[model samples]
Target: MSGMDPSAVPGPTVVDRRRLVFGVLPAAALLAAGCGRSNDDRSDGGRSARPPLALVYNGPQGCPACPETVAALLRGAPRPYRVEYVGGETPLTAAALADARLYVQPGGGADLKGTWRHLEGSAGAIRNWVREGGGFLGLCFGAYLAGRNPGFDLLPGDTNGYIDSPGATVTDGRDTVVPVNWQGRPRHMYFQDGPAFFLDPGADATVLATYPNKTAAVVVAPYGKGRVGVSGPHPEADASWYADKDLSNPDGVHFDLAYELIEATAGRR
Candidate 1:
């Protein structure tokens, strides 16, 4: 949030209240509690007594409710963790990153350029933080931002629309579900304008899931001392999201994939 222009920031919305109701406390509270100031402030050598923090990027760039959706998923993670929204008033900073173990970028609208405009200012801080052993998780549009072309450049290569990839089923950006081989098991997950990764030759990347076309749909890769896990679809999406689009996941609303990605990114897996 530091490098962003104050005037460009969007004010708090009703969704902010929704986030609070979902138990995702604000990042400011943690920062105020000496979570980021210094290692001496914490009894566990910089680790706060509070649950580990997972910072979700909530801003104009992300789709409405997507950040809250991701926060809700984190709340239900197998491990105890606290969720916080970062953007607008609480700009992402080095101190904020210090207290957080994982950072997430959720889905957004089709405005890739606009999304980049809002997040480009904090790119350096995010990159540096991940290089210093912080975790990063990108979902949908967030996955696009993790690539080399108009992104955080956290991935070894770039990403492209899944619709454009070979053997793709969904050719349009409509609210729908697509088939994927998740860890060798066939499953259907929500999809919109998700991306497919094109890793550079010799890049050490793990493919957790693959699109029907066999392209990487969910991937995990190392970035310096840290790690990055990304998904092309919305594994964190809930029943309400499907209800809005008159869609449903045959496998039901499961957060296992999301939780696994979080753990992997956080180096817990």
Candidate 2:
């Protein structure tokens, strides 16, 4: 091993890792020495990196795993993403509702559990945005929020079950797990006030998981020119949510599916 030590590599050596990993790399002659960031293929010639995403969460209901999700995204997201809590704020305030490339909705717990009140005004803009090639993702309540037909009428449907306003308590069956993938497989969800999942004809929703009652646990569909995703379970619930006032019990499968749908639908491009 008298050759160059692997650690001595400098900046801007490899162009694309995929090109190197697959063993189909171009001639080594084209490859530069050392490894680092490059200015080519960048907008400003690498003057600076792309900005982090600004994600807004409407409603007063807070997500326990919100922080974790943001951390995970910042750590691993292909692009940067920032999280913000937007309660009582109009959707039109941000470009996301008007013309975002990808939009993600985190679990707003009870804030979005009302009579579709918060989104009543921005429904049309939301639909238009999706139909215009903007990606939409709904996690737990986020899915429910995106499924609302609102102004666009792109998706027409409603979430089943009835409960009081933000702090109403609904008793759970303790062992009554409405499995997302299949019955008997319990996904831990707590403090939920009867958020039964359902799908309507207008929604054109696809089922990724469900409860024994046949309600759609997870659904995905295309509306107009955009794609929408819904999750009945709270895959965003991380270890903190599980230990604290957890909503849906943290199920590995649910999180994987949520993350997958989120990336597919609302990834920052």
Instruction: Assess every candidate by TM-score.
Output: 0.80, 0.57
In model 1, the Cα lDDT at residue 97 comes to 80
Assess candidate 2 and give its TM-score to the true structure.
0.57
Error of 1 at 8 (Å): 26
Off by over 4 Å in 2: 1-54, 62-91, 94-99, 111-118, 147-156, 162-178, 182-191, 194-196, 201-203, 245-254, 267-269
Per-residue lDDT tens digits for candidate 2, residues 1-269, read 00123343221111121222234433431221221121122232253655444344544433333433533543344443444434345444335554345565654333332324555665666666777766666554454455433212334465533222232233321112234443344454322222344456555656665554555556667766777765555554444433332223444323444456566565333
What lDDT tens digits, residue by residue, belong to model 1 across residues 1-269? 00112222211111111122244533331110000010111122344566688898877763445676677677656675677789767888888888888999876534555667788888999998998889999887788788754679999887887877777887654557888998989988877657888899999989899998789999999988899998888787666656655677989878788887788888321
Q: What is the lDDT of residue 34 in candidate 2?
A: 20
